[model samples]
Target: MQVIDLLHTATRELAEAGVDGGDLDGQLLLGACLNKSRTELFLAADMEVPEEARRVFLRYLERRKRREPIAYILGEREFWSLPFIVNPSVLIPRPETEFLVEQVLAACRPRRGLHDGWILDLCCGSGAIAVVLALELQRDIVAVDISCDALAVAQQNCRRHKVDDRVALVKADLLTAFAAERRFSLLVSNPPYVSRRQLRQGLDPEVAGYEPLLALDGGEDGLDIIARIKEMLPVIMRPGGEVFIEIGAEQGPALLRMFAPSAGAAELVKTVEILKDYAGRDRVLHLLLSGYGR
Candidate 1:
């Protein structure tokens, strides 16, 4: 069939299967099958698809129809304007997480010699944040994740971005493997924050069915991992260090309370504030450790 006709069929199939952005997904998949850019496909809409390419496009279409994420199908996703490999083993990097990177860069850019100690990327899925930080800061980083499979994917990304030598991958649950020596000067994470209730209610089929659960389930209150990170802050973070954590939109207040100055909390915390995403909803929790105080 002609490129245009095949694209129409794929789009209709995807849309009927309840896929969002079906037309765009069709274009991307079809273009991939033909080994052509979307623009090239559009320009050559009248050209007939080769038999082999048509079969591959149909297979890709079926996968999309089953709610598999395009990134998983394509095996890559762009974050911080750099392409990173992704799979079911690791969560696909989202655009909003770029804001977390921006906040970290902004926080460290003004201070000379801020990269003195190690930068820890906790729960570093696919090493997207670590790769970006290593490139942007020219600093050494330790990217940690609990899943060995995720770490494997992260290692590929680090090598792909040519930051393998700079960004070390560690398999550990949070900071459990690290010594309590306050080694990290800066920390960033996009831990699982989707509440159990939220998951039970439902997420898009692409997310609920395909993405790694270890990277999505934030536990009963969605703060299980976040809280654990909070508890380890005193041991892992240097006095003047800062932590940037990506959070759910409605999680800002709860995080604030969790880190608030109370009997057991906020002793090591100097400042705890939530940064809003583009939509003005809480998306990142920026915490400053007390002592040398930046």
Candidate 2:
């Protein structure tokens, strides 16, 4: 069949299967199968698809029909304007997570950033944040995760981006695995925040069935990991250090309460701000840690 005919038929099939953005997905898959750019495909819409290309195109259609993510199918996702490798082992990088990177860059703009330049990237899936930060700043990033499979994917990404020299991948849950006497100048994370209740209700099949649940489950209330990270801050962060975290919208007020000037942590946490994304959802928590008055 001609490119245009194949595209039309594929689009219809995907849409009928309840796939969102069927038209765009169809074009992308078809372009991949034909080894042509989307623009190139359009330019030669009347040309016949090669027999081998047609077979690959059919396989691509079957995968999409089963609700696998396009990024996983393509084996890449764009973040910070750079393409990074992705797979079922790691959660797919989303645009909202980029907001966390922006906040971190803004916080470190004036200084040399990571003094002695030691930085910690917790729950560093795909090492997307680490790769972006490595390129954007001169720092030593120790990225940690509990899953070896996820770490493998992240390490590949670091190598692909030529940041392998600077990013250290660790297999640990948060910071407990690190015994080095190190203090980070800045700490950044995009930890899992989806609650058990949220998952029970069902996510899109692309997410619910295909993506790794280890990267999605944030425990019962969704605050379990966030709260744990807060407790570990004083031990890991340098005086006057900053933390930028991606958070669920509904958790803003709760985070405020958790960070409120309390008998134990009031003096340790200097300032807290709930920043919103373009969608007006409360998305990130910016914390200024200056220590408990020396």
Give the Å shift of residue 13 in candidate 1: 1.0
Candidate 1 TM-score versus the reference: 0.97
- Identify the candidate with maximal TM-score: 1
lDDT per prediction? 0.90, 0.87
Model 2 per-residue lDDT tens digits across residues 3-100: 99989988899999999888899899989887898999999999999989888888888899999998999898989999999999999999899988
Candidate 1 differs from the real structure by a C-alpha RMSD in angstroms, to one decimal, of 1.6
Mind giving the per-residue lDDT tens digits that candidate 1 earns over 191-255? 99999999999998889999989899999989999989888888878887888999999999898
Write out the backbone clash pairs for model 1.
none
If scored against the real structure, what TM-score would every candidate get? 0.97, 0.96
Model 2: CA > 4 A from native? 112-117, 180-182
Q: Every model's Cα RMSD, please? A: 1.6, 1.5
Error of 1 at 51 (Å): 1.2
